[model samples]
Target: MLALLRPALWLGSCLRGYHMHAASTQQRGDTSLVLVDEARRFIQDCLLRVGVSPSKVRCISEFLVVADYRGNYGSGLNRLDYYLSDLQSGHAKVGAEPSIISETVSTAHVNGNSALGVFVGNFCMDLAVKKAEDSGIGFVVAQQSHDIGMASWFTFRAAGKGLAGIVMSNSAPTMMGPNSKSASIGSNCFAFCVKGEEYHFVLDMATSVKDIGAVEWAWANDEYIPHGWAANEGGLSTCFPSLALRTPLLFPAGGHKGYCLSAVIDILCGVLSGAQYATHITMDQNQPSNLGQVFIALDPEFFLPNFMERFDDFCGRIQNSQPADDSEPIRLPGELERMHMNYVEDLRAFAYPNSLLTKYKEVAERLCVKPIELAFDRCQSRKSF
Candidate 1:
């Protein structure tokens, strides 16, 4: 069992470390540090102007802000354009709500009615957590939702309530499946979070060697991704971001194993939820993605005594493990994201790439909303520029 778990453990460290470097160039130039409150308000105002409901803006803005705050820039406000475009194009329904199609004590199936991903995800996950609170476990699935940002957002929500959280989503197809010559599955990302006495353990990742956002970022920044991240339609590895983005047949991480896992996620989120699957789902702004997602929550207190005590002991053993690198210590699943979130909070300002900031301003202007207010001067309490 330990051996089987080693790859996942290693991947958690490697993915988090790689994200720091991959998104490093995105931290400087054309960027401004703004108070977190300012950022949240900016997003809320923009969404409001773009026809999002007043009641929904807070939840959506906070979700995106948390993504940026956690250093997951790919799924952060950088993705705001996608949402705006979808809503503008009528791909996502404005002021829409999901309806429960079927339900039991601990499970539910919902139809999002083409609502924005953030709203559907929040609604469904909150329902799942409430059910877990009442019944000790909950499972919820939804269809016809747009992009849900990061899966961890939902898992962390449950974790915040002292319950174990698990989430999975099937995105539009961009991954090359095992033994196939073309794209056959979505990136099929997933997140799992466990509540501990001190910190929550979160393992959130896509099953791809690299998500499409990485390729898009590389294209935008004129950078090159390392080999094995993507391939051409002919199935040949390529480092050219243009080709990778144009013909995004991304490699599955861990080869066949990752491919298999992605397929299973699609089964649960797509097939089981009765949402669009495989090539039928499109990521283009001209069409609704019709994404599917599942959220599960389990209350440990209902199952065992000393759950937190056991969690702490289990995590302590991993943290105390010998480190092969002198500069880096072993970390638990969600520790890296938690540490980054804290680091950003400690600074009291979040940094974004100049390009993304510019795009945000452009979108705000297009929507007839005021430009985002950026904090321009540095202070003893927080850094800005």
Candidate 2:
């Protein structure tokens, strides 16, 4: 009996060791819970090492990390690899400062000089907000920059300063119209923020059916995309290798209506700003490309003395409207994003797939930053929901 018991105990110990090793591997495979503050410091340190001003580095790092923490993976830390690629290939000039090329009392045009778009965009928005504060309106057109991340961030910043804001940017040619067979347009996006007495009304959306990053993420995760979500050679929905060959051209969310908005934005941001538009633009594959961004800020008080009160009342009425479903209530624009932000904050981690985590680790390794580690807890006591 003693010998048999010893053998069973030994077997159990081996099994436990195997489980421990497996758990460690799983932890290493997960990279969603990257320490925000640590990542920010790492990026700032890198920028400083590359001779960027400390204050500017802080601003750019905050924008990037905030997007990461809020689960906007496309605009988040994942973008660092692209920035690094541009820097290494000399497509993007690291540490190059942006300059105002032309200016008026209420408007300015900036030359980013191939700098990182986030830094350039922030600088432009700051100038626009300052002008609006003094003149009741301001507009800035920024050209020759890379991906600037989420448009909502810049608009929200202006809104926080008691100004209504609108932002639009033209990206690389990655979208196609319902009638077009190939990518003939950029994934233009627009964001708006209106000030109110209670809470601001913020709206941000990509003109495409889905963000390109979403498609890439789905493909990496072995997920099937809905047919209507992508375009094909015949201008119909398809998932063929060729259709999926490039960043699959996304259908506009509201069909032709969103396409119209995309066209308008491309015209205003790309053509009007004298930047490359549509198929003429090139992807950021270590090549010189022209991208344009436009930001507008308005002091609502200039139009109406009771604008804030009226806006707040309108928001309340919308919030208290009848629900479309018994379970879930209707939510205004920006409400869902705000909720997700809160949820991510409480969780302290995002539900990222292992594949994405692998890519992130690769990026961290390439950047010489310590790869993120995952934390997990096992609950022995189960509770009924």
Candidate 3:
């Protein structure tokens, strides 16, 4: 679970115990290929230092690492700061647990009790998978949680077990409404996953054209964002990452379609679960998010008995289709994630940007946790993963 890795291993590919300071001094001009185990341990140790439950730390790490491995870099280590900030601000309660408030044969409502979102996500996803096995379908919702990291973490777990999975969560207002001057809507996100015989399809995305993390990355690298991605305080499309970050009026993906889709997810995760929706979920400013979420699992065994065969047929046809550009073959939803997984496994490590690595190292220095092992010299590896 990345900004940890899906194929994380404790010992392999490179030397260990190498600290950031030992590698570089002032200019963070290049990336590092870090041992997966070292990175995972670093995240856990940092969270532990911040008072997270030992057992719950694994879930949070899994969420982050998976996102990074799946190419959702914005949700990966790029987001570690958000979690640490919450704990440091005393807004996120340490070691809090979720409780089920009500349930039926195929549905349940939960109260996260202000726990870190990953803990809540783990509990709810487990319940959903179990219920789907027993009843053919499971639908669970929760309120009072924090950020759940990535929706793919929940769906990936279920799809890996041969079930279809769906997840959605509401968020702070980070997108703009049509004609609005500043951000006035949430970037509500959702993910869907399903497994076939030889493939699994995963779709994880924000309703907005892009998420805040993507914007942050562009800004950090001193690059202009793509046109149509977001707007500035003046409600005009702007390429300036700093301006976009300042006002944060992300353009809805596909215009009205994206807006409506986010609204629908908000109703499911926020309204139904009694959690704050849209603007009610505050941005930064040291306040608990109290976010709402929905997790669902459906068993193929109970329906579509030829599910795998049908999926193969569908894939074969797509695979055979001719591409307009010979170099750019069509790809399925989770293909990039699978490719990243294999790339890391082959190298036995994860690649990280110098900017992010510097921040992570600073975190370790500040918290007194062990530094995550990393390699900066070109002799260590020929290229970034």
Candidate 4:
């Protein structure tokens, strides 16, 4: 398998950014949680080590923390090594700004020019939201970026601004179609967000039963991955993540229906954006991945009256439904994520598993940055959504 996360050969090439002088006493404590402020510092410092500017680092790091805050563990700090590897290989450029290729009142085509994926994602989302506010809807296609990570950050940004938001990203394919084994289409992911008067509706999902990242986490932690999420090297079903990563094929979410839907998403994000799709997207670590992303935002007020109230009503109805188990309460989508964020807010820290703490320490050492200060506390780690 052509794993993008493989360690880069040119590790010293992208290490010229960031400032001199260090934060002393940064790595002194052992802790159960990483605070919001501490996580930001750690992220910023890591990005700086990779030659990202201070200003750009600020924007990029926030969403990474937000992913952890909202319990999207895969897209959070756990994925930092993948991104730094992209930079170290000189594929993901530092300080390259997104360029608009063409634009109409409500639509746009952009070339990210190999910028940081988060920077490109934010640039597209901001433009989409502005256009939506002006013209009732906006659709933007962006190319030459990879791994935007946690699309909900962009989707929820638009939803917070009174717009219905949709974000989709295409990846180098690892999914297998019905007949072919090996690897085929991408494990494409999308995120949708809309606002209710009382709640935010967030549906962020990969077309696969579970993303490869979750499977990897299971492998590293020696936890059991549920059946049907992945397959072993021979392309047969397996709950073992270690064996699954040997070949790295994830099962489709809805069997045939999911395979087709994933293809359509590849069309929207890849083909429609004039980039590669499916097996065509590059996997070579030393070159730009040239993946494409799409963002669409719509002003709900333009098409419907009492939109928030109606959405809230639907959320209420869903939550009020009878549960299969008497003790477990039915919750709306994004509810548990909200609860997790609230938990962090209440504690003013992230009580992550010990593995993450170890990962953080490793990343800090590798990047030559101060590790995030963690103060030990004895508490059960909350299940990440």
TM-score of each: 0.87, 0.83, 0.87, 0.86
Off by over 4 Å in 4: 1-32, 353-356, 377-385
Which tens-of-lDDT digit does each residue in 1-385 have in candidate 3? 2223212322211111111222222223344567666667888898899888777788778777776666566787778877888888856778678999999989999999888887888789889998999999999999998888778888877887789999999988888776666665688889999878876678888999888878876654445677788888888898788889987789998988898898999999998999998787776647765899999999987898898889878877887799999997887877766776776676656666667788888998999987777744323433454
Q: In model 3, state the lDDT of residue 194.
A: 88
What's the alpha carbon RMSD for model 1?
6.6
RMSD of each: 6.6, 9.3, 6.6, 9.9
lDDT of 1 by residue, 193-279 (tens): 987767568888999987887676555444567789899778888878788877778999999999999989988998899998888
The C-alpha stretches of model 2 lying farther than 4 A from their native spots are 1-32, 38-55, 232-236, 239-247, 377-385
Give the distance in Å from residue 193's predicted Cα in candidate 4 to where it truly belongs. 0.5
Instruction: Assess candidate 2 and give its TM-score to the true structure.
Output: 0.83
Worst 10 residues of 1 by lDDT: 1-10
Q: How good is model 4 by TM-score?
A: 0.86
**Candidate 1 CA-lDDT value:** 0.78
Top candidate when judged by lDDT against the true structure: 1
Q: Model 4 residue 31 lDDT?
A: 22
